[model samples]
Target: MTLPHVHIIGTGLLGTSLGLALRRAEYPVTLSDQSPTAVRLAADMGAGTAAEPSTADIVVVATPPDVAARTIVAALDTWPEATVTDVASVKTAVLAEARTLTGDPVLARYIGCHPMAGREKSGAIAARDDLFLARPWVVCSDEDTPADRLAAVVALAEATGAAVVHLDPEFHDSAVARVSHAPQVLASLMAGRLKDMPADGVALAGQGLRDVTRIAASDPGLWTQILAGNAAEVRAVLADVRADLDALIGALDLEPGALATIAGLFAAGNEGHDRIPGKHGQAPARYSSVTVFIDDTPGALARLFTDVGELGVNVEDIRIDHATGIKLGSVDISVIPSAQVTLTEGLAARGWWVPEAAIDTEGRE
Candidate 1:
């Protein structure tokens, strides 16, 4: 069977990545971009041919949020028979703008989607064919949407190995505002503080700071467009954050009830953190950690995991922290609470050096 021809616009990270993934799925794909260099780069990277298509079965607008709406309108007009979709992070405003720009019934062909997958890097150079693997891809379709058109977009999203989720456009915008845009602003703000720090202070940074500031490395030009497009929604989330910040500051200065305020804030954070889904979108469940000391050598980590697997305890998650100024690392292996004691004892019996405190899994239970 002949797969649908999917023509991608913009040829940046998402666009190129989709083109690459679709091509791998045996779909006919053509790519174009405002920058000829970008399209050529994407093609050279095996994404697709850099050319304009007379028509396509589907047209994806992977341009930045600022240009996404007009681009969607253009795609609809250019390919009246094609199903169109945009992967812009902001949805409500983009859909509204497209609705305003076109009076043609082709407007119904335009579907807004946000693939909740990206990296800190940008451009075709950083594009990966598996970028969307197992990531959430939000499809904003309503009762007014045509069944075939929506199905085409969903198929396209699933073709890239993404998990498709249906959501209302307004709700999609509001949700991303709190989860994505606001966090980008906060990361950028926190990262900005490190710029003027003393060299020694900067050198002291560890994985914790890296986790918080990682997205701060994303494109400023693109983020400015995203934050501006979702200003009202982002502002709402930020306002709540500011309120919490002000309350904390006031408590510190006012002295009375200071400790209670701090404790309450931390407790609120813990409650919120637990709401985040675990691996494979499962409900969050408390897992017990078994930290093991391992030599910082190539096969050392693999050997430890092999030993753990032999012990028959499923590994839920893992983290490794290098011991400062030493050629040793501590690997924290998270497993179901029930398996904690067996895994700890099993590893120690195998000479894996399980920490004495970690061996007492009852405390964590």
Candidate 2:
């Protein structure tokens, strides 16, 4: 099949990553950005050559949410024959603005898209060719969007190894506000509390704290644009979160039935967490975690994995917990419940330390 030549505007992380993915698949890719240095850096990093004054089969506007509509309209005007799409996180406002900025024909060729993939970091330097692998890429199409243009956008998404889902612009905006935007805001708020803490207090942090606040390291300028663009939807979700916070705070004051209310909140949180899909979009499955102690030295992890491979046991997930002030670490390997006994026996017989009491199906030691 003949692949479309992809012209990407805005050489930030998403745009550069798209260029690299397309180029890896042997599709012709051209890259351009308002920042001359960014475009040059992206090209040097094997994303694509600097875009020349030429036509393309598809134009991808991977700009921030604030400028997405303007960039999409401009791309449609510049590449009249190409299907234009934008990878902004928000959709409804961009689509609405694009409609006001251009006529029917131009609007017909433009599709709004959002790739549910990114790191906490930003810019071309952080772009990875496989950034979209196994990630959800939302294609938002209105009734006016041309069928062929929509298909072109889907094909582009697939080329980057993304699972494509079609959604209306309004629904896409609201859904992301709940899942993506709200979480970012919460993470930032939590991390903000650490700013005034003593160094000794911060030193006591662990994996749980790291996981919760990881996205707080994201680019604030970019997030400001994203949060602003989806303000209504984000605000709606935040209001619910705020109400829950108020309830918890009130409970802390020892109101009547306060303990029950707090316990109910915890229970609800656990249920919500379990509802999140696991690998391959499957329903969450219970896995048994096998904790193995290892020396903090090179090749220790490799040997463990090799032993697990030899035993024909697939490791679903792995977490390493390094003992503070000790030359030891614990490797927690998650496997199917049925394989727990066999894996434990196999590793123990191989002279590896497998604590008999550490094999738990509940994923805790």
Q: What lDDT does the true structure give each of the candidates?
A: 0.88, 0.88
What residue pairs are clashing in model 2? none
Candidate 2: where is the Cα deviation over 4 Å? Answer: 357-365
lDDT of 2 by residue, 93-127 (tens): 89888889988776888887889998878899999
lDDT tens digits by residue: candidate 1, 232-303: 899999999999999998888758789899899999987887787667588776788888999998999889
Candidate 2: residue 269 lDDT (0-100): 85
Give the TM-score comparing model 1 with the true structure, all chains together.
Answer: 0.93
lDDT of 2 at 270: 83
lDDT of 2 at 224: 90
TM-score of each: 0.93, 0.94
Best by TM-score: 2
